[model samples]
Target: MHYRRFGKTNLWLSVFSLGTMRCLAGESNAEENIQHAIANGINHLETARSYGKSEPYLGNILKKLPLPREQLTITTKLPPTPDSQVMDQWIDESLERLQLDYLDCLAIHGINTWEHLTWVESPRGCMQAIQDALAEGRIRHLGFSTHAPLEVILAAIQTNLFEFINLHYYYVFQRHAPAVALANQKDMGVFIISPADKGGRLYTPPAKLVELCYPFSPLELNYRFLLSDRRITTLSVGPANPQELDAPLAVADQDGSLTPQEIEVFSRLETQAETALGTDRCSQCYQCLPCPEMINIPEVLRLRNLAVAYDMTDYGTYRYGMFENAGHWFAGVKGNRCTSCGDCLPRCPEQLDIPGLLADTHQRLNGSPRRRLWG
Candidate 1:
């Protein structure tokens, strides 16, 4: 597997780390998959308190493995809270469940809002407890994982407190590009979260995308795309079984730079999108904003772009269904909430019919509310 320097942390990490959110006890081959990932040189194993039973399940597997503790890097996360004592308890609980004396990294999980950022920054809040842990040799490095918007993400990086960041940034969703750049400038490790599943659900990609990414599956292309940027430290591969690890394993040895032919495939994909979308294509300039109902017009339109251009109806529907139900993690109203006030029409450079397209997005993508993969 290819290894890269994880920014200011000074640790060399595998380009693909094993994310343990899907490592539940119910999956019969979970242990085997973990073993397979380790055997293939994935030393970093990441889990969170919200991922039910993952910590203990991984702990059991680790206990049975022949490798010594120092050979592996372990990370876990907990939500930020105002109370330091409570934060300390949560950290203790995670460590106890993992049966580990110390963690290589600890992330303040799900800082998806300004309030969460405050909780971490507040004096005598979670940061104090985390600092105490660091001093006590319980945690070697501190970081945060977020599903927040770009503004929030940039603000978090500006704090200069974190050594790493786990976030969503992949081929299909590049909205957080600035955040990645800022993190790199800050000398922070940038770990991408859920590239295959949340990265446009490439595991069951549309045929058009498969064809566009010739000589590689859509999954490999997405991983390669993220790896192309040296700022990105790792991509989380949340495989549910041993077989699910094969796709990432195939691409692990690669240097992540796109060849000339691969660049042509990306150009082709863009051309197809432009051809299909025409003037309706959203540049994601975000000029149209401050929706009365808090609808994320750009995101909705991006989903529409996927559904219309790439035949990603399943991915569009799945994400659209999470609009309101996902709380801070998604933080938006459905496209149907557009008031048609025409306020955004004047702000858009493309002068697209913002409300009409939003209504159409609602028609095409809206479905039953779906919760996030983990709490």
Candidate 2:
């Protein structure tokens, strides 16, 4: 696999890291899946204490695999909650579960708010456990993973206590670019989470998206687009089954730089997307933000685009239903919370009937099963 200098850590990290977020804890095939990933040159395995059964499952798998421990880098995280003692116990449990003595990195998991950030950074809080781990050589480096607002995420990276930051940034959601740029400026590693699944459901992509992402599959398009950005260090994949590893492995082995034809194709894809999404859709210009009820209007509207433009109604509905209980993770309330005050209407450059569209969004996408996945 092609490797990159992972920022200040100075590790030649493979661009595609194996993520076990979706690994069925204790499944028999888990070992084979991991072995396949390793054979394909995915040298990094990122999981979390919270990822059910993944830690212990991987631990058992590693014992049977012939790969040397030194050739692999394992990372796991602790959620910043309860108290530092709980955090310490979780770490100990994680090591026990992984069958490993020391971790390459220990991330303060789900730093999704300023309060969570404080918990990680404060002396008497989670940092105490981390400091103890560092001193004991239980973890080589400390970092954080977040789904906070760009402002809060940037603030977290600016703290400089982290050597790496795992966050989401993909072709569909470029909102975290500034945070990544800040990480690059600070020489911090940027681990992009879930490029295929969360990055617009490319695995089961709509025909329109498949067509627009011509010459390359939608999955490749998404991967190459993110890899083209110099600031990104690694893209994560969660492969429970063997086939899931193939696309990521292929992408990893290739020279990441996009060719001139691919670059031109990228431009055409944007034009094609706009055409497919239609002229009257929410442009996502951000002018319609700052909703009175703090609703994530643009995101809900993007779901609408998925339904209407890409004919991905099932996908759109699944995403919309997730906001019902995702808490701060999905952030602001869905479009159903729109107060119809026309506050965002005047700001919208598209002159969209914001209230009407909000109503339509809920009617269309919130009636189905809510599918939620972790990165």
Q: Which stretches of candidate 1 lie over 4 Å from their true place?
A: 25-28
- Candidate 2 residue lDDT tens string, 1-375: 888877888777889988887778456777777888888888888889877888999888888878788788899988886478878888899999999999988888889988888877777787888889899999988889888878789888888889999998887777788898899999999899888877877888888777767788989888888887778889999876989888877777665578897888778866766777675577777788788798889888888876776676766876787785677667777787888988888899888888888899888887654544543
Using lDDT as the measure, the top candidate is 1
Q: What does the lDDT read for residue 49 in candidate 2?
A: 80
As for candidate 1, its clashing pairs are none
- Score residue 281 of candidate 1 by CA lDDT: 89
List clash counts for every candidate, in order: 0, 0
Which stretches in model 2 have alpha-carbon errors above 4 Å? 277-279, 285-287, 369-375
Return the TM-score for candidate 1, rounded to 2 decimals. Answer: 0.98
Error of 1 at 316 (Å): 0.4
lDDT values of the candidates? 0.90, 0.82
Q: Per-candidate RMSD vs. true structure? A: 1.1, 2.0
